[model samples]
Every structure is written in C-alpha cells, then in structure tokens.
Target: MKENIALFLAILYLIYRYKTYKNVNKIIEDRIENVHRSFFKRIQDVLQCSKEDAEKVGLALDKYFVPLKSKFYKIDNNTYSFVDEGGFKGSFSIDQNYNLLTLEYNGVDLLALH
Candidate 1:
C-alpha cells in the first residue's frame, strides 16, 4: 500500500540521517584522538610517563571503567551499555582478536556483534 511505502521511505530517510550524523561524530572523535596521539607519540617527549603508559591507562579507563562510568557508546563498530544505579549496576564490552579495550557488564559481553 502507499501508506506502507511512505512509512518505509521515512524509515530509510531516518536511517540515512543517523548514519550521516554518526560519521561526522566519528570524524570529530578521530580528530581528538589524533591530537592526543600527536602529543604522546613524539619521540623526544619530556613527560614523566612514557607514551606507552599513557596509552595503556587510556585503554584501561576506556575498556574497563568506561562502561561502568559512561551511559553508553559504540567503539570499533559495536555498541556497549553501562549503567549504574546503586546495587543495580550494568556494564558491557565488545572485543574481537584482542581484549585490549573490551568491557564487560556483570558477566555478559554486550559488545559482541555475534
């Protein structure tokens, strides 16, 4: 029916808009990461801790603690959940090939695409 077709079209349009927005958001995030990397990846840095340590800490905070602290986010093409309300705590992580930044909520791996 025409009504169904119109609804489908609307859904497709919404999807298009969402994808575009996500792409822009990702670009912004990448730029921010690049800025950090540029500073830390330098060979002759004067910082107390090495760039590797900083990267590790960043990974730990993001992969392990982020889900517990943040509301929700997607990383590496997968979505994750993190919610805490007193005793009712929730968390999740997604990882494949490596667990470098994978987060877990309770006992469930919410980040797995499979």
Candidate 2:
C-alpha cells in the first residue's frame, strides 16, 4: 500500500509539472505574438503603406528585433540589445503595454517610438 501511494503521488506530481510547462509555453507564445503584432502595427502606421509592404519591412526588422525577446537580455526590465554578425548593435525598449517605445541601431535612432 505504501508503494502504491508513492507511485500515485509521483504521478500526480508529473501531471502538475506537465500542466505548468504548458502554461509557461503558452505565456511565451502569447508574448512573442504580442510583440510581433505591435511591431507590425507600428511599421504600418509609420510607413503609411499597404499591409504587404508593412509585412515585408516588419519581417526584415524581425531579424534584428526578435533576438530581444529570445536572447541578449539585459537585467533591466523592458530593455534589450542585439548584435548582428557584422558587429552592428541595436537596442530597443518596450512599454508596459508591449509597444515599442524606442529603437536605436548603431547609435542611429531608427524611430521616435512614441
């Protein structure tokens, strides 16, 4: 009976862990999707261009920007940096609402990011 109880508890713990893992993955997915959407919207608004054009620009920018969410994280919240293979470095910040507040590439201000 003691062995059965231990096995049951282990099973319960595994289920709990699986659920927690799924929740964490979902949260990450949602955050990434939100960032991409916000970036896309900003690109369209700034360029005053069609959806296709905005998408192309956004996709290209993603090469530099997505790393902010994936890697090169700073201890400071909402700030991230990216360095390309060519040694071009960039930084950007996100607001509480997931909006891009600022973007700088190689010391050049890419956008006002209001």
Candidate 3:
C-alpha cells in the first residue's frame, strides 16, 4: 500500500545519507594524512634532518601553529600567514601537487635554514 512505499523510500533516503556522510569523513581523513606527510617532508628537507627529527619538530610546532585556533591571512592562492595569540607566527604555502613550497617561523625561512 502507499504506507509501505513511503516507509521504503524513507529507509532508502537514510541509507543514502549514511553513505554520503561516510564518504565525506573518509575524504577528510585522507586530506589530513596528506597534510601531515607534506609537513614532515618539508621539515626534513628544510632542517636537513632525519625523519625522526622532523617528526619531533612537527609535533612541537603543531602545539603553536594550529590552524583552527590561529589568526590567519591569505597571502596568495595557496599561501597563508598565521599568528597564534601565544606569539608564534609563521607562513606556509602548498603547491598544486600538495608539496609544501614554503614554511617559516618568526621571520626565519625554513627552506633557507640549512
């Protein structure tokens, strides 16, 4: 009857919504992983350090450079400058390939450090 059809349609809608939500979450996770990898690579290259060292620095920096809590300004299409209330300041840029092109802290250029 019409009541049965309505119930079936509602179930289908719920299933569709669940799948969409799952897919969105997966995309966000992948993007976060990518960012982490890119940051580690940049740190390693700039600091001329090993993976372990880069990871250590990255973890420490994360405490101050959190994007959500920092005040940020868009510098260009793929670049942004940020300052945390605690006095940490930096800028970063990512290329189309998700490679980090630039990273700086407190007016010191990471790429030119060593």
The candidate scoring highest on TM-score is 2
User: Which portions of model 1 miss their true places by more than 4 Å?
Assistant: 36-114
The TM-score of predicted model 3 comes to 0.37
lDDT of 2 by residue, 32-76 (tens): 588766666665654555666656655655754543232233525
Top candidate (lDDT):
3
Candidate 1 residue lDDT tens string, 29-114? 89757654643333113223456764553354344444222333333243333454443344333334223344455665534532
Off by over 4 Å in 3: 1-68
Would you list the rank order by TM-score, best first? Answer: 2, 3, 1
For each candidate in the order shown, give its overall lDDT on alpha carbons. 0.49, 0.64, 0.68
* Residue 52 in candidate 3, Cα distance off native in Å: 22
Error of 2 at 13 (Å): 60
- The residue pairs found clashing in candidate 1 are 91-105, 93-103
- After TM-score superposition, what is the CA distance of residue 10 in candidate 3 from its true location, in Å? 55
- What's the lDDT for residue 68 in model 2? 25
Q: 42 in model 2: Cα distance from truth in Å?
A: 20
Which pairs of residues have clashing backbones in candidate 2?
A: none
